[model samples]
Target chain A: DAGITQSPRYKITETGRQVTLMCHQTWSHSYMFWYRQDLGHGLRLIYYSAAADITDKGEVPDGYVVSRSKTENFPLTLESATRSQTSVYFCASSPVPYEQYFGPGTRLTVT
Target chain B: DQQVKQNSPSLSVQEGRISILNCDYTNSMFDYFLWYKKYPAEGPTFLISISSIKDKNEDGRFTVFLNKSAKHLSLHIVPSQPGDSAVYFCAASLKSGNTPLVFGKGTRLSVIA
Candidate 1:
């Protein structure tokens, strides 16, 4: 129970509504990432943070926003969620380079 | 353009046999390669990884072979078991530090009993 955790394992939202998926890690990893997994897209990164207050865009970052105000927390926000954004979102943290630890994942559905 | 590609979307292997999962990358700058396994509705967990400096890295029943020249890599699971059935993903990164990983579409591996 000491690794990473995601809130609301399952979520149902409506289009044009805003939703925030939370990711928290107890390991205090220096790096944190938000990735959305779709059928044929594998895991596409939405955003990543190097440390607190430092974030950058990834492959798909149009409607999504992420902030790392603390090293242990990285929350991804979907501003005005759309049906196309429905996917399983995963949060991962890494203290080093090669190995990454992931949260259970949050299944978000926009109808 | 997908930087990492997993041509085979799915692979079926019988129990007690070998399960080979292949991955390829278009970018030669990628220096680190890794494999992860994901169960339904769960996040992927790191399985094995091989750096560009090495061609092979082994851990228990999982072995990763890196062919730098071909820009290809493979993961081998020996004597596959039913529990090994999951979606296997291949990822790559440029180098150390905060570089995020580039993941392939993944291959659904079914190890039948």
Candidate 2:
């Protein structure tokens, strides 16, 4: 398609295991982001990438890791997954800064 | 601290009635506000947006109102439909084109038939 897409729409991993969530945008937007939606926290940003090889920590980034070696892909990695890390992860991209388009989402469950 | 907050967790409205969703922000630097609608198992989609320079912005049956002094904004849906029964999220940003947005929790709206 011509929009953003995410892989492993659903995942289940054990604690202490490594899991990676992939995000790709066909638009080649400069800015890409990862957000986790929780029951009470709403949508808390895990991390974001302004461009290729440029990534920054967002509101909540302790247990999560992200890398953007390419403009079209930004993947989030959980080096050591924890039970609390379970949540629906959303990948978003924006050509500019204000309006952002989101992908379907990846639901990850850590047991 | 939570910069943006959505107090209501869920709302129920009858079909053809008006659905009013409210949002509040504590950040003063945020000048741009946006509302997103999300359904089950899908990402949030953009619905409407309003800038600080204006008090209100309207699009079709959806309208957004901003109150700078009160540090609040609201999304009004006229003649709510069952299809509109989804989670609504309010987000804010600096409009500087550099910073990321701060999003509120979200409100689940159910348009009862």
Model number with the top TM-score:
2
Q: What are the runs in model 1 whose C-alpha is more than 4 Å off?
A: none
Worst-scoring 10-residue span by lDDT in model 2 chain B: B94-103
Model 1 error, position B11 (Å): 0.5
**Model 2 interface RMSD, one decimal:** 0.9
TM-score of chain B alone in model 2 = 0.98
Q: List candidate 2 segments past 4 Å from native.
A: none
Model 2 Cα lDDT, one tens digit per residue, A32-96: 99999999889998898888998899988998888888999999999999999999999999976
Clashing pairs in 2: none
Q: How do all models score by TM-score?
A: 0.97, 0.98
- TM-score of model 2 relative to the true fold? 0.98
DockQ of 1: 0.73
Q: Report lDDT per candidate.
A: 0.93, 0.94
User: How big is the positional error of residue B14 in model 2, measured in Å on the Cα after superposition?
Assistant: 0.7
Q: Model 1: clashing residue pairs?
A: none
Clashes of each: 0, 0
Which candidate number would show the highest DockQ if scored against the true structure?
Answer: 2
State the lDDT of candidate 1 residue by residue for A1-111, as single tens digits: 689999989999999999999999999898899999999999999898888998989999999989888899999999999999999999999986456899999999999
